[model samples]
Structures are given as structure tokens and as C-alpha cells.
Target: MLLPRGVPEAGRLAAFNALVRGDRATVCRAAEVPLLDQVDLLWANGWQPDDVLHHTRVALADAKQRRLVPDLVAADRAGRSTQAIDPRWQQQLDDAGLGDAQARRGWLARWSAREGLEGAQLVLAVLAVVETLRVPPLDFLLPPPGRPDQPLASAASAPDRADPVLVRVRRLLAKAESTEFEAEAATYTAKAQELITRHAIDAALLAANRGRNGEAPTMIRVRVDPPYADIKNVLLNVVAAATRCRVVVLGQVSMTAVMGTASDLAAVEALYTSLLVQGQHALAETARSAPPGARTRSASYRSAFWLAYADRLGERLREVTDHVVAGSTDSDRLLPALQSQADALDAWVTERFGTLGTSPVRGGWDAAGWTQGRLAGDTAKLATGDLRPTRRAIG
Candidate 1:
């Protein structure tokens, strides 16, 4: 078994020794185990919560003083008021890295009681704080695992290659995105989205039955590229979610690492590239109408527009997904397999980042740009087909 970083020295060495019965261990320099798992290990080995907290606090206080992210994950049911935490703590809860879901909602509620931001609002804040920590991973006494070694799957062998329906779907979206009329665009986009959604789900079921052909869950980094990397990041995130994958922006690099099965990854890349093209075109049109002297304001509006577009895409996808799911007769079998696939992909994320962290975005909203972007987003489609009359693709 692979133990994550930051385990107590004695227990870690014991586990390391256990793996030495002639079988090699593939350790990671940065992978992390769950916080509760760490907590349990400590307790089982004669350490108590008070001892755990004391050690964690001491470690965290030092990290905080050094202006580094703390390697601590607070017990979920525990109170989170900083008055009791080290007075020297500088970073707010929302800005810090904490782990993914903790098991204790009650602890979160109690922590929020003193601050008066209870329920969902407070829970979100606590989560944000937890999202920021990057606990130091335990060192591999042996050797670390190698980097992603496989070459990119060839486009010829890729999932989209033989699927002509997907080819049509892509063309429809490309046409839909370029159209002048919102109604025409929406109808084309929706139909295109519908086609892709059905295809993806169908592919998933096929893969599930094929025992996934030895394809384990994997992560692929897709570059959002820059100029408006932030805007592109938002688009990438929405596409990942729409495709049943998860994405994490890899800080200032203009790229995101997406977690999904290989098939879903292909779907995400194909759909996102097309959507991004459409989005950029829409933004260009938004820019054309910018009145003189409001350049800065117009830029802000464009930012807000893309953000709203991303938000709308998420909603639109869920609506389409629900429609697809409801219409399926085999959902009892289909849903579980899809869910199992989702859970497996999510595990890869946990192993990689330990705790996920994302910062809030601000400043995208010019009244003109906001309206245009939102309207454009509503017209954009994923894998859902809602056909209305439409002008054909432009020259």
C-alpha cells in the first residue's frame, strides 16, 4: 500500500518496512492520503486528538510564520475560529488549501456558529480554507514513480475517429456557433450537444462492458493558452464538468489538468476546442461594439461575459444530462457504472493534489458585454439537440 506524505516517522517507516518483503513500492513525491486516514493512523499508534492537534498546530504555526501554506487539515467537526488558532495566523480560511470533502459537516457547523456565517455560506468558506493546504508528502525511502510515460493516443486511434456521428456533431456546433441569429445558433448548438452527450454515454457503457480495455483513469493537462487565459480557464472548467470529468487550474500556467477516463478526456478536448473557438468569436463581436473611451470598461465586460457564459454552460449541461438520463430505460445499470467511473477518476485527483484549491475571479462585467456573453452562452450547445429552424453554416 502507498502511504502519502507527512505521516509520522515511526509509522511511516513501519509501513515502508512492510512493503520491503521483496515487492517494490511506487511512491509519489507529492501524492497525499486522506486527512482522516492520517488521523486514524496516529490514534491507532497511541496518539490522541489533543496530541494530533498539538503537533499539527506546531507544524502549521511554523508554516504560517514562514508565509507558506500550512500542511494541516482541521477535523471537520471542529470549530474554526482563528481566536483559538494561532494568533499569528495570517492567511484567511478562504485563501488557504484544505483537503477535498471532510466527513464532518457537524464540526463545520459548530466552527461557523461563532462567526455567524452558518449553513452553506459558512461551510463553503471553511471548505475554501481547507482547499488551500498542501501537506508535505512523505518521502519515498525507495524511489518515486516515473512521470506519465505513454505517448498521446493517436487521433486516428482516438475515440472520435471512427464515430461519424461525432464528426457531424462537431460540424453542427461549429456552424451553430458561427451563425448570426441567436435562435439558429441555439438550436444548432443544442442539437449538436445532444448528439455528443448520447454518444459519450454510449461509449462509456461500451467501455464499461469491455472491462475498460485495461485503461485506468488518467490525467491530461490541456493548455488554455494565454492573452485571456483566465477566460479560457473558465471555459475549460465548464467543458470538463459537462463531459463528466473534473479540472483543476495549474496556477498561472495557462493550463488545466483534467481527470477522466480516456474516452471522456477525448470528448472534453474535442468539445472544449470547438466551444472555445465559438466563445472567442463571440467575444470579438462583443469587442466590435465597444464605444470609444470605455476600452477598460469594455474589457471588464468581456471578462464578465465569459464568466457568465461558463456559468450558463454548466447549467445547460445539467439540464441536458437530466433529460438524457431520464429518457434512458437502462439507467439503473447505466448510472451505477457511470458513477463508479466518476469515483475512480476522482480518486486520481485526491492522490495528486490532496486538497484542491481555486481562487475567486473578479472584474468581468461591462453591461453590454455581460448581456452579449450570457445570450451567446444560452445559445451554445454541448451534447443536447433541441432543433429549431436554422440558417446553414456560414461561408
Candidate 2:
């Protein structure tokens, strides 16, 4: 029996105060009467009912805006039966200085629309309509219950805690014994190969060219047009990180001595693998969703990809820094070495494209050209022994 419209300003203030003081019951009680009833009571005292109703609704809306409705009944009723008030409701209520439940409902509706919930609902509706028209029988039965949970046995409770396959490979690489290193390396190599093969298969499926050939295509081609260099930059960053890690690992420059931890090699390997996996996923998703004759522009996809990479990089950097700060002999020297690698990577990235600060598509190619010129000049200088001021200095 609560008024479906608004509440009075004085009444709303009182209600709001009551709610703040944990006296929700009082507010709810006052709110329960119809607006007309309250207005009629007021009219008996020579007050205009219409004016009172308008003021009341405004006050009610204001109270609602303050989240002063503490009574579970009112809260539940509002949450369940009402959407949100619209801007119009707010505009109307603003003059009266009250709140309107209908206005709140309208506002919620608008919010849902902005969030694309309405689009989702439309999609569901279309699917339902299609089902009704073409496959009526699908609506006849509910889906079966999901798999039931099983009771854990003692063995399950004490499950084997062997390291992940990748971790095992890293440990094997760290061993001084050639035989041990070879064995673990073989396993790790096989796993990496398998992952690559699986990724190829997925790419083939996504391309929808499965039956055309006995084997999947080795290289998946993508054409990203101008104005989308962000995508390429992000991809390049991932590749650069992986390549640097691999070089450091394969070079066998005593990571513990340089980076302060042999474990850093394993961490780097893990990061490389993750980056590769994520790249493959991104490529696959792009291939699947891209429209026919679509050329990539704006590099928005790559930008999105880099945001995730940046997050991972930040986390890994923190872990590495923490290890160094802990005084771990193998970890303490890693920060400077990593910084050097990062610098090299930045140089490579700049040479390949341009500065990270520049526009991805507009300035990218020009940057790449400039980088190439610099590299050529350096190479020529190196070849002519021009790097050293004196010939003896080089010796």
C-alpha cells in the first residue's frame, strides 16, 4: 500500500534521518500510505493535494537517492519491482525536492542499456524466437543436472605434488649433469612442440580450412592495415620479451651470477611460454571474429592485448624485484641485468617500428625507416673500424 509515486521533503528528511539512525521501520511505515491519502489529509487543512503530491514524490526520490530505504520490505520491493528512475523523473522531482520510485526504475533501465544488457537481452530474444520457429522441441525439456561432486578419499587429500611439466623442464636445464639436462630438455622440448602443434590445429579450425589439406598451415597470415600499429607494437613487445628470455637461457651465461638466481631462468621461460600462448590465443580470436575483406586498422586489438601483457609484466617485475631485495645471491643481480635486457628490447622495438610514445599507425612506418637508417650508419661505422678513435684502442 506504499505510495507508488513520490514522498514529501520534510517527510523524506525525517525518513532519511530515521534510516541513518537504524530506524527503518518508521520510514517504511510512513511510506506505506498512498500519496492520495496523505494529500487528502493535508487538503483537509486547506493545503492543495496536487502540490503536496508533487512535493512528496520529489522528497521520496531524494530519500531513495541517499539510499535511506533501510527497511528490507521497501528495499526488496524496490529492487524487485522497480527498475530505476529516468532523467525526466529526476528533472520533475528536482523542483519538488523529492524522490520517485518510477524515476529510479527508469534510471536503472537506462543504465542497463548503456551497459549493453539490452543488447544481450535482444540477442536472447532473437534466439528464443528462432527456437520457437524452427526448433520448438528444444523448449520442451530442461537441461540435465551438472556432474555431481564426489567425496574426496584419503589418497585425494594427499595428492601428488609434482611440479608442473614446464617447471620440471627448468629444473632439468639447471642440472650440472649433461645426462640429466638432456633428459629434462627433451621432455620440455616435446611439450613445447606439442603446444605449437595444438595451436596450429586450432588456427586451422578457426580458419575453417580443415578438409582442404591433410596438414594444417604452418603460418597463419594476418594483414593489419594503417592506424592500428598499437596491435603490432603489443605483439612485438611479447615477441621481444620471449626472444630476450630465450637468448639469456640458451646463452648459458650463468644466470645466477648475472641475474642472481638460476631460478630466474625458469621464471623467464615460464613468462615466455605464457606470452606465446596469449599471442596465439589473440591471433586465433582475431582470425575467427574478423569480417571478410576486413583489414586491421586502429591497432585497438593489439592495444587491448598489451594492456594484459603489461599487467603480467608488472607482476613478474615485482616478483623479480622482491627476490633481489631478499638478498638471494642468485636474484640480487637480476634487476640491473633485466634493465639492460629491457633497454636492448626497447632499442630493438624502436628500430623495428618507432618510439612507444608516437601514434601507432600514423608515425610507425616513419619511425621504422629512421631506425633502419641509424642501424645502417652504425653497421657502416663498425665495418670501417670507425667506432674507435684510434686503431690501437680497438685492439
Q: What lDDT does candidate 2 reach at residue 21? A: 48
lDDT of 2 by residue, 4-98 (tens): 22687777565445444433333223433332233223323322212323223333323322222212112222342433433332343345433
TM-score of 1: 0.54
Off by over 4 Å in 1: 1-160, 207-215, 295-297, 364-368, 380-385, 388-395
Lowest summed lDDT across 10 adjacent residues in model 2 is found at: 135-144
- The candidate scoring highest on lDDT is 1
lDDT of 1: 0.54
Please tell me which predicted candidate would have the highest TM-score against the true structure. 1
What's the distance in Å from true for residue 77, model 1? 56
Error in Å for residue 202 of model 2:
38
